[model samples]
Target: MNEERIIELEIRQAYQEDLLQALNSVVAEQQKQIGKLEETCKLLHDKLKSLARAEPSPGLADERPPHY
Candidate 1:
């Protein structure tokens, strides 16, 4: 093989390695974000469930709408 051809091949390989590393980093970050999102969703679900089960304070029904 010619020297130029060998150099080109090496450059291409380096680029491929860098691309793979970046992709892996992106995937790791995405996985972490997904975990956080799942926890947040669960917390929101629990809060909504508690609010649904809790009784309202007395006279809440007496609040007037802006149309009033």
Candidate 2:
């Protein structure tokens, strides 16, 4: 009986170890994706800021037409 119990415990441990490894892999992949998304967001933000700088301010474009 004791030997059977030991075998059962060993099986459970093996399964647990496999599950832990799979979960760790998933977490690592998610972190990599998150890093990529963060880089993309930063690049887009910088591009928007540069574009805003290149454009005219709000009131400048709304002036009366030359026909006035």
Candidate 3:
């Protein structure tokens, strides 16, 4: 191959490597955000569960409204 062709190939390879690194950084950041979201979901779920357990049921089936 000619020298010009070799230089072009090298430049293309360098650009590809830079693009790959940028994509990896973005993916890592997304993973961190996802981890935080999962933890928040779990905490919300646990809070809701605790609230449900603490509150007594209204037992509407056994009672009648004032309008009745």
Model 3 misplaced stretches (Cα beyond 4 Å): 57-68
Give the per-residue lDDT of model 1 (tens digit) for 23-53. Answer: 9999999999999999999999999889877
Locate the minimum summed-lDDT window of 10 residues in model 3: 56-65
Model 1's lDDT to the true fold? 0.93
Candidate no. 1 TM-score: 0.73
The 0-to-1 C-alpha lDDT of every candidate, in the order given, reads 0.93, 0.95, 0.95
Worst 10 residues of 2 by lDDT: 56-65
48, model 3: CA deviation in Å?
Answer: 0.4
Question: Candidate 2: global Cα-lDDT?
Answer: 0.95
Each model's backbone clash number: 0, 0, 0
**Runs of candidate 1 exceeding 4 Å displacement:** 56-64
Instruction: Pick the winner on lDDT between candidates 1 and 2.
Output: 2
Tens-digit per-residue lDDT, 25-50, candidate 2:
99999999999999999999999999
| Residue 58 in candidate 1, Cα distance off native in Å | 12
